[model samples]
Each structure stands twice: as C-alpha cells, then as structure tokens.
Target: MTSGAPSDWYRWIPEQISARDYELLPEDFCRTIEVVDGHIVKCESPSRLHNRVARRIATHMEAGRKPEPCLMVDTDVDVRISDVPLSLRRPDVIVYRCLDDDAKLYAGDTVLVVEVVSPDSSFHTDTVEKKAAYAAAGIPVYLIVFLTEAADGIELIEEYRLSEGRYHLVCLHTRRLTVDSPIPVDIAFGDLASG
Candidate 1:
C-alpha cells in the first residue's frame, strides 16, 4: 500500500501492478527499489567515486558515438521488462541504441544495461536473477562494474553478450588489467577506476 509499510510487494507479478497503483508509490525513497516477480529488490546508488567514473565513461563514449549511436545514458530510470498482472525492476543505468522522446514511465528494449555493483545491493539476485532476466529479454550487452570493496579496491568488469538464447561472458578484466571487448567499444578499467 504505502512505501513506509513495507508490505510484501515482492510477491506480485508484473501483471499485478496496475498503472494507477504504481503511481501511488513513495516519491522520496533514497535507494532505487523495484518489484520483480513480486519481490522488492533494492538498487545501489553510485558513490562519489562511482558517479565520477560513470560520468567519465559517459563523456568518453559520448565523444566516440556516431551516426547510429551506441547508447543513451540514463542515470536512474525505471524500465519495464514485462508487465502482465504483477512485477517490475528499475535498473541503475540502461543504455539504449535509440532514445525514446515520448517515454515517461518506461522504455522498451535496451542495447546495454549496466549496474555499478554496490555492497549493499543483493549481489546474488542482481548478478543472478536480473542477469538472467536481461538475457532472456534479449539485451545485447550487460556490464557489471564492481565497486563493492573498501580502500579504493579492485574494479572488476564483466561484459556479457547474448547469443543462441542465452548470455555468455565475452570478456573479464580488473582495474590492474586493461582490456577491450570484442565489440566496438573499448572500456578501460584502470582509467575508470581512478575516476
């Protein structure tokens, strides 16, 4: 009912949430939380360092993106993967090859989806359930940027590409090791981690 009540909204399916009901949600909740398969999943906000890195990446990519455009950077937007009668999820960052001008509630298919890993988030679900969901939804690229440790720790990046009805890890690298994906874009972990 109300965000403060903390009812079991997680148990609902996408079809269960009506357009009218979704509008009743709280306005000022700190972290991003979404309902998927009736489960309430909380998303992590970028740390000052994480925000800096994301901005840097966006800037670099923005400079290189051409004609067709690789993707549009949405900081924190709600995306509807499926809606039947119950659940939903608003990922941290969604990169779409095409930006929707009229979209207010949510957008359609996205090319790449990225989530800067947060220690507070339920890593198992994000890395497992949501990953599978994105893959099933046929998202071309999924990037998980790890920013969970203290002491300015390791920045692990894993890039997954969908193929043959599933997602496979195409590349993996740490901040100490700079690596490029077989895809068109090159992400420098070392460069991103510092920012």
Candidate 2:
C-alpha cells in the first residue's frame, strides 16, 4: 500500500510484521531504518563532523587505491543480509566489490562497513551484536571511529577483522595512526574528534 508492506502501513494498528513486510519503505523517506529479525532499528544519523570525517576517509581510500573497484555508499545505502529475510540495514558507509553488470537491490557481499558510532545507536547492537553479524556475513573489516571527546579525543579507533568465523580485535589506535590493512589507510584521530 505504501513504502512498507500492507502490514506496516498502519503504524498504530496491531499486526504481525515480519522481515519480508519490513522492506516496503516509502521511497521518499528521509531517514533509513534497518529491519532486523522484525525489529526496526534506526540508523545513526551523521553529524556534520561525522560526515566530514566519512567523506575524507572515502576520498582517501578512493584516491590512494589503484583500479578502485568498490562502491562507497553513504549512510542512506542499505545492505541486506540473507540471514534474516526482512533485515535491511544501512551502515554509515559500506564498501563492496564492483559487480560487473550486476544491478541487485542489496549488496550483501560488502567487504567493509564503517560505523561512526553515535549516541542514538545502541552500544551493544553496534559494538557487539552487529560486530558478530558482520563477521558471520564475511565482512572483512568493521571499522569503528568514536567521536566522543575524552582524554583521547577521538583516539579510540577499532579495527576488527574477521577470521575463521570470529571477529578479533586487530588494532586499537588511541592516537593519529596508520592502519596497515587489506583496506590500507591512515586515520587522523583529530579529524574524527574535531567539531
């Protein structure tokens, strides 16, 4: 009937909403939501500073890499994992291999997903649950850049790499540091912490 399925059309009305029913979102909606296991989770909105940092990261990655073969979508891009039928999640940024003549709705084989952690997102969901979920989906790198200005001042940069079905903390940089990775890049801690 609308962007969502017939069931999700009425917000206040009581009806069973499944994953399949959750994908029917209005095309013009400004915000993007992730339907995980029938629960609607709002994605973290990018602050101006967050957007700046994200843009820098994507730009650097794109410029430095030769034959750049990945698609970088902003926070509004959705990546659906087949694990749950109705689960449609929009990462702050996602990088996936450029498919040849593949015009699929969702890019599930995303190699990297970056989340600029925000106050609106559930800590456990982003730092823990989503970590595991990405690993299960074969997402190689899950980068988290913290914006909270503490003693480190955006120094808490986490690089979790998936290996053998588990995500192990590979590097935790508390200062402006370079990460030697399959992605290959340096992150300015100040850029992330700055207003």
Candidate 3:
C-alpha cells in the first residue's frame, strides 16, 4: 500500500512484507510510518525544534561518552524488538554499542534509545507502548524528551533505566540534566534547544 491510501491497508501485514515490498513502499514511508505489531503505524515528524533538541542531545552524548566504542546516531533506522508480531520500532536517536563491524544493530547493541514526544496520538504510544518495548528489548537506557504543550509548555526530560525486565524512572529534569548510565553525558535543553 502507498501513503496515499488509508492506513488501515497497512495495518497488518498478513504474510509479512519482504525487503522488496518495503522498497516498493513510497519514498516517504521511512519518514512517515513504521511497522509495529505486524501493523503499519504513522509516525508524524516532530517540529524543527524537536529535531534540534534531538541533535543536541546526541552531540552531547557523543562528546561525553566514555571511551567505549558506541556511536550516537540520529534515528530513523528500523530496530526489531520482537518476532511474534514482527515488531519494528524506530526511535528518534540511539546510542548503540557495537560488538563488531556489522552495520545493522538491534536491542542487543542499543545502549540508549530516545524519543521526543510529539503532539499527536503517538504521544500515548511513545510514553506507554514504546517504553515497554525498549525495556523488554533489554535496552539499558530510555529517555523521553517532552516538548508538546500538554507537557506544560515547558521542556521536560524523563530518563528510565531498565531493571529486572522493567523500566524504572531514574531521573526527571526540566531545564538540563546529566546522565551516567549506559554512558555519561550532560544534556542542557535550555542551552541548546532554547537557543
């Protein structure tokens, strides 16, 4: 199905799409939708401000990362979380600690996954479902950067750490925060995004 068609058509992949099928999808498919639970879910891109926030955080994380071999990459890459429903979720940014020269990486290599909350219904999925997915994937860190007005018109950063197959809220910051888990980094939302 193409983007022009209704989302229902992409909802569930009965036979599961192959790479060629994925390629047949419209050019905007990668930017607008992702497969989740064997269904295609639209992922509305956040505002330019959100992109700046994500980039800043990624840059800071890259600079502050310990000498470990991980690389902080701007997201938009597919990450397989499960096989039962053929779940594939793409985060806004990811810090992956690679074990070898292979390019594609999944939860095993993902040290941290971040999502900048958008204003649409995706907010629910981002906060609830995605959190659970990341935890179950055994990702060590998950960070949600809130920018939507319902978030009180103020920038909010919530960081969760995976523990015992669950995500525990480890810290919350309104302006700026520093994290030492999965990696060590200082994120100043005010200093970066606000500017």
Query: For residues 31-130, what per-residue lDDT tens digits would candidate 1 score against the true structure?
Result: 3667665445555555776676566555555545565544566656666676653355666556665656666434345777766666565577669887
Clash numbers, per candidate = 14, 5, 1
**How do the residues 56-154 of candidate 3 rate in per-residue lDDT, one tens digit apiece?**
777777777666565655566777776556677888888887545445567777888988887554688889999988998999889998884433333
Error of 1 at 103 (Å): 1.1
**Candidate 3 all-Cα RMSD:** 4.7
Quick one: ranking by TM-score, best first? Answer: 3, 2, 1
TM-score of each: 0.72, 0.77, 0.79
Instruction: Report how far residue 44 has shifted in candidate 1, in Å.
Output: 4.9
The global C-alpha lDDT for each of the candidates, from Candidate 1 onward, is 0.61, 0.63, 0.73
lDDT of 3 at 61: 71
Candidate 3 positional error at 138, Å: 1.0
User: Which regions in candidate 2 have their CA more than 4 angstroms from the true location?
Assistant: 1-23, 68-75, 100-102, 105-108, 119-121, 150-153, 193-195
